[model samples]
Target chain A: MNRKSKDGKILLLQGNEALAEGALAAGCRFFAGYPITPASEIAEHMAMKLPAMGGTFIQMEDEIASMGAVIGASLAGVKAMTATSGPGFSLMQENIGFACMTETPCVVVDVMRGGPSTGLPTLASQGDVMQARWGTHGDHPIIVLAVSSVRDCFEIAVFAFNLSEKYRVPVIILSDEVVAHTRETFVPPSPDEIEIFNRVTPTVPPEWYIPYEDTGAGVPAMAAFGDGYRHHVTGLTHDERGFPSQRSDEIDALMRRFFRKITQGFHEIQRVETFMMDDAEIAVIAYGSVARSSRRAVIDARERGVKAGLLQLVTLFPFPRRHVEKVLQQCRAVLVPELNIGQMSREVKRVHRNSSRVETLNRLDGRLITPREIGDCLIKMYY
Target chain B: MAEGMTGLVHKYLRHDKKFPHIWCPGCGNGIVLGSLIRAIDRLGLDKNKVALVSGIGCSGRMTTYADFNTLHTPHGRALTFATGLKLSREDLTVIVIMGDGDATAIGGNHYIHAARRNVDMTAIIVNNQVYGMTGGQYSPTTPYGAMTTTTPYGMVEHAFDISALAVAAEASYVARCTVYHAALLDQLIESAIRRKGFSSVEVLSNCHIQFGRRNRMASPVKMLEWFKENAVRMHATSKMKPEELQGKFIIGVLADSERPSYNDEYEKVREKARGISVEPKPPARFEG
Candidate 1:
């Protein structure tokens, strides 16, 4: 079956292409990125399409500049994004921290590949799960989303942009080489069908506007560069007026607002999928490409008279802890499987509150965790 | 006629922000700031249309005083940020302020690349010869044999001629001026900002508190005298021999050329994509 795109034509789209199209649909008018494997297609697609929409696309010298440009463009009252793989993603951490400190809204697409240092460029791995959460130094709040399929790629990119704009924070969408390069049937949402969220502009006059003022809602209205609101923006620990403040109280209040905006808005940010987990003794928790394999394993286990269910994580950073906690209390034994050596499983272990036994299935040789391996593990745990 | 200095200050500065700035007394940064505002005032550009982006250092704090849409970014990345701002809002005038270490040492890649790409922005790099904000560490433009906190046993590396590097990188406009020459500094900055492509103005500023005390020039006056006695105009250097210009540096515009800016060239790409003559019509509409 074929699904219609914006032009009302059915098309087979790569995951990267769908992600770019989703960004365009989300009103992303500016893209700045350096070309890297597994993620370069996102940049290529944006370069080809952004101009037709009367948008801007720039191939910056490196990922550092690319991240800087995206943040800058976002401040100029346009939605902006950047894409990179592991190596380039590592280079973007400096500016990423700046974005967090300044509360700038932008999107970063990191296509996961095997890595410690320029690790496998073409092969798939979920190694960047931890890096996405704690890559930049300091205790900062970040939103990380994972895609399990090509269609998920399209939906998640739009969600990422909306979350970033609504909260005024940088959002990261993690895609592995498997999903980014795979071709699948895609039905893009029409412009009117999907809701779009833009950053809130200042409603007050220029004299009353404070660039970083916390209005009890934790998010402040933003003003563009050329707007009459001549406000100052800095990465320093700033006061309500956006000037660098060394006062202990001001710094404490500002840092608290950064976390408060996300934790308080989790209702709009977090998502998870539970499959047949209502009355099951055995459960599997997974995310990204590994979730697809785990879903298959759960279905196969049920056919063999074993009660098995699957928990698929979409929001990875603010770690869907409450949902995972519910599953932990209901199930007797849970298995966590992933491509990397137990990154997300650690989060599962951290949220363990009940008497349920938790175990992890791991792989690191640039290969996807197969359904057979997960099924075997589920069978052993059940028997 | 140029506006009175006090009027320019009143019109362009943010009075509500932190006054009594962080720069040391007798610092040349204040003079450079004055020249910048005078240049902007002389050009008659609207305050709402100017975007002043700065990088980390003592120089980066310039944005705190300016009334424009000021942004103080991370160290060495002001050009990158300015590039995005200018490309997105080409209607606005963009200016980037950076220090010696901020522009040449940590941001050398962006400096050269911004020149190569020729984005329409003016970069005013304050070459104070040392990183004054970080306690006088020797920077990329620290003169050889000059003493700094990092170069205790006399400096071993050579200094970078920032304007020459900009010229080599093919910046459409490149010029050099010193803080002591405030009037000339205003003219160079005004012209650089008016140019269509990437323009760099390297201001030889004095860190009287740091580099000046460590070197022979112990006070601001001594540093100003050094700039006055050792500088030669660019036109006069052609007549003078190499021996006469051994220790002296050239001042004035070194390179100015006409080339299409990145934005103008990108417009052509936009036309090729969406122009009626190039784009083919859809053969048939899809029936749901």
Candidate 2:
């Protein structure tokens, strides 16, 4: 099928540059980061771009401070973000956990390089999918979005910030090195084209404001510093007034509310794009740069009459499990080809535990999974 | 209400939510906290425009009882958060309070960098010579020959003159005072809060339970007496020999200069970036 028409002005960009421009467009006025491989472009762009926009950009001493600064800026009532690859992302986990515990809304873009202590800094790998979910300590909830192409990076960057502000949480934009380094034409939408969300504020006067009270939307309205709210915010688990309350009942209530906030908002939190799935029996699931190959594979499989389709996962966390399970219920078997070995495949299998066999096409050699490799799997699985 | 200082304490402390503030009885943190409150009160800074950030430990608890926009961060990370918050919103009077270990031990990197940058924030470090909250463990400031849980026999490492370190690290304003010198501590803090660049005060505070119990100075009065007896003034330091100053430190304003703050420097950067008075004009917001 030939694509017909498109709107918006075109600008050629790499995945990392798209992410930087996308974040700026999404109302990110504060960026603090330490440079790391495959993700330095974002920081460079911010350093070059933020100041002219009357925003703040800082090259922090390290990644821990970068994440801390973003959280700090967010608490001061401005949208903020930081980007890093795996090693820097590892350092960021400490404050990432801090942000989650304190319920600070911000964005973190982890352009994936092979990791587990800087395993292939210059190469591409979808190695941080699970790290994006469980990299930080504790059972705290997080939202992560995966981008497959340059244009998608721009779009998802906006979505990531929107989800962060709407839910008052940190949202991770996970991009692989292939997507990060490759160049593509990105269309810039008009200002009103994308929806932006700000943290909900208490309508009541400052005296009556309970900083952590559930706003019936599973989120506590956040008051910015200097807003005359004069509320205490801490990393320790606390009660409605935002002070450290260690009572077991209070802990349980707060913990349950953290999960409910993301779980109840699943419809908005989960995003996936389906291609040629109607009347198809076999599907290929992929994300980030691997999805680019999977797209070509699905197209070639269709030309060969294999009845193959593509399930592009845009939202990797809160893991679109229900939707994936529903899609798997219609297919015979799904092929998952990612840049890493069996990260998201585990989530897919767990979701479709008894429904169908979940096949994996993994690559760990720092190279892209080509279209033939995916189409071969499709042919073999379908026949 | 109770009369005298207790009345001011009652009025300033957040008694409803954060009462019985985790601080132990006769703790010198109470004295140090009182001095901080008196300084802020004397400054007449609007509570809404003030922000108090603290790191993990006895000192971090100060944020909870303070009725400002307070933040209690992880151990050793208060300065980084304060820097971020202050940089983003230059309208707030940001103040950071940390313990000896929280400042000079784990967060030493952030402490020095914040000072080097000379950001417009006041950092107050309460040096009780040991990590009291985690038990009587040796901290960065534990003097040589001091015994603690970590150093069973005695501390083999040399102690840091935190005030001198701040002065060396290019902080715009640095001072030192003991909890015993309450009124002088108030005056130094008032001047620090008014300083336009990085300002800090190393308070040679007390730890009656931790350092006191381990070192045979078990009572609160004995610790206060030690501070009163051993404290030296900044003016008197020049007359004393280096050997004579052993096991004691001077308490006064050690350094003060009107260096341009990081916030002010960043403004010039913004102006240069936008070509406000020269060169080509850049696009607004995200367009560039």
Name the top lDDT candidate.
1
DockQ of 2: 0.49
Q: Give the best candidate by TM-score.
A: 1
Score residue A96 of candidate 1 by CA lDDT: 94
What's model 2's lDDT at A139? Answer: 91
C-alpha lDDT values of all predictions: 0.91, 0.88
What 10-residue stretch in candidate 2 chain B is worst by lDDT?
Answer: B279-288
Model 1 Cα lDDT, one tens digit per residue, A144-205: 99998988988898899999999999999999999898887656666678888988999999
Tens-digit lDDT track of model 2 for A77-140: 9899999999999889988988998889999999998867879999999898888899988999
Contacts from the true interface found in each model, as a fraction, amount to: 0.64, 0.59
Instruction: Write model 1 residue lDDT over B1-288, tens digit each, in one string.
Output: 355777778888876568979999889999999999989988999999999999999999999999999999999999999988988898889999999999999999999999999999999999999999989999998889999999999999988889989999999999998998999999999999999999999999999889999998989999999999998999899899999997776899999999899999888878777765432532122344
Instruction: List model 2 lDDT by residue over B190-267, tens digit each.
Output: 999999999999998889899999898898899999999999999999999999998886899999999999999999
Chain A vs. native, model 1, TM-score: 0.97
